[model samples]
Target: MISPRVNTRVWQRSISLLSPQAAKTESNVVTKERTYIENLSKDIATSRFRLVDENGKIASITVQPDIPICIKKDCLVSIHNLNHLSLSYKWLNFWSNLIKFRSFKSSLFHRIIGSSVLEILAAPNFQTSRRPFDSSRSLSVLNLTGTKDWNVFGKDSIIAFEQNSSLEIKSPIFPSARSLVSNSSKSQLPRKFQILNGRGNVLVCGGGLVYSIELIDESDKILVNSRNILAINGQ
Candidate 1:
């Protein structure tokens, strides 16, 4: 997705240099070189772009119109055409305590301002960073075309997703039996499982180093510990 376009002039010059007899005379080569430089300047002026890297993790994307992208909170290094983009919190689970906490803060902020709703944007000089431990966790960038509908994920696994994608709490099975079997050593166990459902580009933060395995069939199913699941790709 981030491959740079090749410059044809480089190849042309190399071919000319390699030929014993002049493929292009010195005067012709100089003319072509000047023309190439002029064209390169035009391309840069009309289609300029930049790569943003923070904490040595590079997010290379060309700023374009109407392309929806999801970036994790505190991960953005820089952006262009700020006026053309919109930002909002992508609700993952309304029932989760994290959402509840955020809602409470938002409400209090709005009440102080005497507004029904409040939206905030970063100031031009504002800055943020991921903790060292957090940065150690791998980030996975996925390109989805809306073909797969079902995705099961563990709690806190999703870092960010496009606005159009929908995520809801999913309980794959009743946890009563699971609790009895898995929680014998502990006093209690969580009685539910949470999953995200959507189709779009998503960034998932794994607990640690993350690896993926393909599920060939029902018989090949591998039970991943809940904490280790970063994202599920298909139905």
Candidate 2:
């Protein structure tokens, strides 16, 4: 019987022929990916709110009249009102109105109003986290329909709201005698709450990432620390 010899050279040749094609395919994929990333970065740069860093952190926000924004007075980098949008403010307290701290009564302002565009930037030192209101994530956006009510813990964190929205500063509800005596921590007690309701969006600034959790039914209940609360839906 004659033994047939295997052609090792043929196998080597076949592999050599396929290597360049695989390398070219990989290079094409990498080039396409890089192009996509560049295009996405350009789009974000031209967007209304542009993130300053690669980490999706926004350093400045552009305000449009149709979508007004409220921000802390200290966080204001610059205000350009070329369109002459209505700029107004609400007093956090009677004293705040009378004193006019920082030439404005309150710490927050409605930076945009009417049919024009406005541009504003966050201060470099400003470090508060900004996120859209999401109930499931324990976040709250102020939207008042006049039918529902929101109890905001403090006025300082409120950034902005719709032009039509209304805010009522109310004294904190008195704690029960038992709570007063048993609760040693004064911070746990209610101090003041801003009753907010209206027909537009409200921007709130939180110390950290804003999140919210919703209660589905009457049986669903959770006790949250008062200091950590941003806002509560009174509905």
Candidate 3:
């Protein structure tokens, strides 16, 4: 059996906005908000986390971490199941090294790099919103209008982000005004792109090179060989 990672407490002092608020779940959530949700095929090997839909048909979900659930119905695959190196989020970088010691406590395998290996950060960005995201399951909320998505916020996922993986702050440019498109299509991924807000853009963070994002807007260009890109906030 694969040896599981150890339990590490995630620090939340950086984001005080989430203190008075809580993560949401499946219920009557997503009222007047543009919500996103991607179905799952199997449970991913996440250490421990929750899911919350800001724009959902439901208000809140109830499942917690460490409690495995058996599939009772036919499963469907997602973009995350395809194992495409093209759609990868590079989180390891120079700046991350600065805070590596700060995150040592919340991680499992901190310094191992391999094709089959996945590294979990000791500190995942916190997603804070007006109503507060409901992290009942594996859903995460990144409030863009708020300080959440504007800067680094929300826990980074080991898997690709979807509606089931994370939430993004609606930009003043579109979406919230119903004028933009949701970047969940697989064809949008570049030869090298990082997972961010379930969308694909030419990631330039961590001092990487700029490259084409492929099959979409030219600005969607992502940087090559960089995974520190947690999400793409711009178009």
Compared with the true structure, the alpha-carbon lDDT of candidate 3 equals 0.24
The lDDT values for all models are 0.37, 0.45, 0.24
Say which prediction, candidate 1 or candidate 3, comes out ahead on TM-score.
1
Question: How many residue pairs clash in model 2?
Answer: 10
- Going through the candidates in order, what is the number of backbone clashes in each? 0, 10, 37
Candidate 1 regions off by >4 Å?
1-58, 61-64, 67-70, 87-92, 97-134, 145-147, 150-155, 165-194, 221-223, 233-235
TM-score, cand. 2: 0.48
1-235 per-residue lDDT for model 2 (tens digits)? 3235854443333121112111233344335634554565454321144334322222445554565465555445566765656655544444443342233334444344546666665432243335322212221234343456666665455554434324343333442332223236433434455556543444454554455454444444445687877767643
Give the Å error, residue 163, model 1: 2.0
Residue lDDT tens for model 1, 147-196: 44434344434444434424233444433443212324432223334444
| Tens digits of per-residue lDDT for model 3, 1-235 | 3234522222211211121024232223232122322212133332222222232211121222322211101111111222322222223322332243344221121221223322221112122222222322222333222212322222222222222233331212111221233466222321122223432111111112211122233333323332333334444
Q: Which candidate is the best by lDDT?
A: 2
TM-score of each: 0.44, 0.48, 0.21
